[model samples]
Target chain A: MIKVKKEFILKYGVPSLAVIIVAIQLCLVHFQDLSRWKGGGFGMYTEIHYFYNQIHVSGMSVDSLIKDDPSMRSTLGYLMLMPNDKNIKKAAELVLKTTHKDSVYLQIWKPIVNSENGLYKKVLANEIHLKKSEL
Target chain B: MNYWSAIEIKLKDQIALASQLLLFMLGSYVFILAEEHKLWKILVLFFGLIAWLFFRNKTKHPIIWIVFFVLLTIDLFYSYFWVANHHFMLVFMVLSVILFSYHKQSDILLKNIQLLLVIVLLASVMQKITSKQFMSGDFYYHAINLGGLFKFFFTIFPESLEIAKSNSESLTTLKELNPNLTEHIVLKDVFPNLSFVSRVFAWLTVIFEFLVAVAILWKPKKIGTHIIFIILLFGILFTRLETGFVSLLAISGLYLCKNIKLKLLYVLIILGCITLIITKFGYH
Candidate 1:
């Protein structure tokens, strides 16, 4: 074993250990899915569950995807307005599609886009209350 | 030497070690509570422990504190809302460490720490007093009923029959709606007539917070006052188990002891930190 001086350890040890700990912590971000999931229950909805899961599916930044695709926006809008796994999974699926040319996401979008009553805009505006900043 | 002089000497000698112990304890709690994987949390805690032991006495350098700050900031970003109170404590510890390193003066650092504690306590009092739900005791009632503490107490106490009966029904409905909300209710609330004891506890919480704010500034050299502060802190910790105990341990060390042998305290804190971090593995 290599010999390390007590004084040297005293000076560099804690900070080095701290850096290592931080590095490990940062690395764990990649495996968040495997570690745990706090999906909402009790009639309430968790927006971030959809937000992060959808982001993973889309492989794009939230703002960039929302800007580039109407379907992604509507999926998010559906998530904010509607509760349940089916709708949320539909939103996640929308992100995986190559383009929004087809009206496959219409059911999710109808409430958010087709209304002249401004209900869609209200739902979209309510996204500000969402816990996940990325969503 | 007079009593006041003895107390002052004790405080001057032990405050640094006490603050360090507090930081270690708080850091440990945060590590365990952080939203990360078991392997990662363990790795971080193991390395962090070795590092903390090495630098426990090296308060002379600012780099150690800066490193801790950087780690805390990263943890804050990863679990922004879950561990917010833990983040707050880290921020205070980091700021205090920086101040102590630069000034290299015990008196100035103590004063600043005192100021920070006072502000925190006063702010808690202000929040309690201003909140409509908190004042009316509804918040506490819901919290206690939800946390199951009310049921626990109801079972033990014969005189609390009214509260027990009413709160049991409420608990069933609330838990059915959201099973997780019943985890940790810090308020110790009681419903049904807002029972005299629960109301007293509620008002006393606000008053005690205010008194703690006052105690920090009233007489720094009095042993009696420090004891009162420690008791008040423990009282708060009883209701709120998460972050209050760390502060209690810290304040006990900083303001209570005169010439404490910190080796034992440090070991205990380190152990607790490890245990807490281990607890975090799958919690998040």
Candidate 2:
């Protein structure tokens, strides 16, 4: 029995963990708008949507707000890569705190290609309208 | 002699050598292109080179492996957003080596490495198949025209370069325009039959990846399996110069390889990958 347990663990342990991780990654990709190229799904180069997605902020001066704050820059970078609700909310809150604004508008845009006519366009993948009190 | 004991004794030297090579590969990757954290890069390079040179008996220096593993894990979490898939594989590979260092079991380590290769490839294949853009070949089409790693395709079809330039200009214009404007720019494709070519490339990618995964799982120790891996590596390198990933795959292949000639080839590939990285070839 001990030998069997050892064999099973030795053979199946890491691979099983890998499968579970992949499953979680798929969920993130499906629901949370996580880029297929990230989170260890081995989904690199599978789609035109890459980690270079753009984050747009409205109703505030992003440059003046993030110029001195390295942490906000890093947070925005993460938000570009993963623009899920949580990251969007986090970024919105940061904007609200920095600019002393009542609310901020944030949108994540990903480049997409229309196959029929080869038209290139940026589509909104996620958006958030968060107020100061919403945090 | 007991079966596992004999097997361990037989593979003892080879596993040590494999561990050293993997450490070197990991170190080189971090030093060259990975590890956005500067302090971690220096530490990994220092310890990796030290371990590679002086630590002949890896079991005696468990702390080094532990430190290396911990550093890689920290980096993985720190830069999780931008980290490549191969970076994750590197962490898992180090973990397997750490396990081997503890248990002194070569077979388990080999099995784990084999399984890693299979799972990664299968997952890649699954992702490609399930993605609508990939199946329709739009992804490859965009990549080839966008001029990163797929710029080599321009040599075959020179007119696509002009199209790519136009596309770039249009995309730049589009970006500069109002964000709320729902305008679509029609990207030009002047290269003849480029769509068909992209479809062929996409299908070939899926088929080759699936075949390589099956080959590795079917015969972990056979020369044929190694050949398939080499073919896949070259296939990917031709279009996309993923030197880090190529070296990682070669290191895992080396762990399972017993033949001297193939083993030498794997080492050469790893060194070649390092050289490619140093030269800044295909670096975007």
Candidate 3:
């Protein structure tokens, strides 16, 4: 049994040690995060989601489709509970038509409200004007 | 309509990303240079190279696998799960299982792979179990999504309802993505066949992982089997695992391989590596 064990170690043990060393080398290539390596993480889609969700909160009806679809109950959790914001109501109406019409992201009409358009960028950036009473 | 806004590139960060890529490239290349200068001086280098190549065989494309793994480990240790990382983790867990079956080794590569998967799974489970408070409050709270049957329990509990109902928004793919996505939408996705797909994969994964122990034990009597298994591992690396291709290149250097065979595999792998660099660094 001793001899057999020795033979096993001699044959496979050496090779195994080598693989581990290489793995360590490969593991060192990451710049701290797995997603960072793949061009993920900091994409504009995140901003878009944030932008639309805010619009939905400001009295936009685009989220109504989500509530209608029970499957979306979990995903649209925050959108369903909060009543739409008042000041952004007109902007929300324009945003909702486009969001609900084609993509369902609640910001389809965003093209009409270009980044050059003052309110569009503000909504996209998540900055809302505070009313005196609310303040 | 302007979904294209999803890509927010920071041109200034290129300096940092480029520096990192260069560091790993040069670091990994030193071993190859040494191997060229002397035949058997780098025994450890030899073995590491072979393991990397065998794992990256299928894609016939070379990649910066070592970089991928290193980055992945950093993310795990640093606690950044983001949705993409979640996908990458799932990919890694699957690849580890496949490689665990190839070649006989005394080192704990196979065992370590298994251990890593277990650690990740346990971490995911714990994250969910402890977030019962958050789950009760946030409707889109993943304390339920990929969390599986736990959603049912949370749904009926009045305490959970009041808290969970506090928020009324659907869960987005990018929301709270770092640790695990499966925990939240498990209940809402309610697709009939999707659960079946997930279940099949889960069971198969476990079985394949345990099979590594057996594969190692049987390797001595199955020399030919070892070659085939090693190649299969390479396929899993290149195809299923992103950084695995570079690893295959590193490990392949460890063993004395046939020139012709190495050349063939190298061609396929080179294309992949080039693509990765171009996509990642804008190199032609």
Candidate 4:
């Protein structure tokens, strides 16, 4: 019985854990707009939605904002890479603290293709409007 | 000892050696990446390499594996949002090796790695199949035309470089003007049948990934299975230049592979990936 249990754990344990992780990542991708390129779903480059997705902060480009405040680069990058609400709100709050703005508007823009004409366009994937009071 | 027992011991030793070499190479490559330049990361990499070089045989110590695994876990948590998918795979691979070192179970480690390869490939195929952009070939179309991931193709299709540059400029303009604007910029194709080519490549990716997964699961020891995996690895290396991911896949392949010649080839591929990574010739 011990040998059988050992064999089963050796054979099935890690792979089963991997499967569960993949399932959760799939759900996150489908529901939370997490990029297929991330979160270890092993789905890199399956879609155009990647880290290249743009994050706009109060109508300012993330790059421009970084130029203005270099310290926020990492936080902004985190937000841009995965624009889910938690990251979005965190980034918005950071911008609020750094820039001392009354309210912060954060929007994530992702590239999409019009299949009929093969034209590429940027579409809003997610957005958040945060007031200092909310935080 | 009996002959069979002797052979088993020899094989187990080989597995240990292969795992040590592969992990050392992976650590070196990861440390060399620009994003991994933090002081603590450098110190961990330095200590790991020093221990590996001078006390190569001592790496079988479970404590060493545990230390590396713990540091890697910390790094992953610190950069969770920005960490690549392969980084996660690396962590698990290290964990498996740690288990092997602790329990002295080569079979379990090999089985775990084989299962990992199968699952990752199958998951990739599932994602590609489910993605509307991938199915419509739009993803590959943009990838080839934009020229970062598939930039190696520009050497063969020189005209594609010009198209990529033009497309980049247009996209930049559109972004600079107004991201929320509904204007769609029509992209130029490098060739008359670019769309068809992209579609064919996209479908081929799905088919090859699916075949490789099935092959690994069905007959991992077969030479034919190894050949298909080699083909898939080289195919992705040229097109995507994902040296880190490719090297990880090859290491896992090496762990499951029994044939001597294929093992050598996997070693060579891993070395080539390291060279590519160090030179920044391809994506890390």
lDDT of each: 0.44, 0.78, 0.33, 0.78
Window of ten residues with lowest summed lDDT in model 3 chain B: B133-142
True contacts kept of each: 0.00, 0.71, 0.01, 0.67
What's model 2's interface RMSD, roughly to a tenth of an angstrom?
1.5
Q: Write the per-residue lDDT of candidate 2 for residues B1-284, one digit (tens) a residue.
A: 59757644544565666677777776566556543676776776677667767775654656666766766776777877577888788878887777777667778899999999999999999999989889888887777666654667777867777788877787777765556776677877756576787888889999999998999999988999899899888888888889888888888888888876777777788778867766767331
Rank order (by DockQ, best first): 2, 4, 1, 3
TM-score rank order: 4, 2, 1, 3
Cα error, residue A124 of model 2, in Å, equals 1.9
Residue A36 CA displacement from its true place in model 3, Å: 19
Please tell me how candidate 1 rates in CAPRI terms.
Answer: incorrect
What ranges in model 3 sit over 4 Å off? Answer: A1-135, B1-169, B172-187, B220-241, B249-274, B281-284
i-RMSD per candidate, Å: 16.0, 1.5, 14.8, 1.6
Model 4 TM-score is: 0.87
lDDT of 4 by residue, A1-135 (tens): 998898778667778877887898899888877778888888888888565577776656666668856568877777666778888888888889977778988888888875446688888878999998887
Q: What is the TM-score of each candidate against the true structure?
A: 0.51, 0.86, 0.27, 0.87
Off by over 4 Å in 2: A49-51, A59-65, A133-135, B1-17, B32-61, B155-159, B279-284
Best of the two (3, 4) by DockQ: 4
Runs with alpha carbons beyond 4 Å of true place in candidate 1: A1-135, B1-12, B33-62, B148-193, B243-249, B252-284
DockQ of every model listed? 0.04, 0.66, 0.02, 0.65
- Model 1 chain B weakest 10-residue run by lDDT: B178-187
Better of 1 and 3 by DockQ: 1
Q: What's chain A's TM-score in each predicted model?
A: 0.29, 0.85, 0.23, 0.85
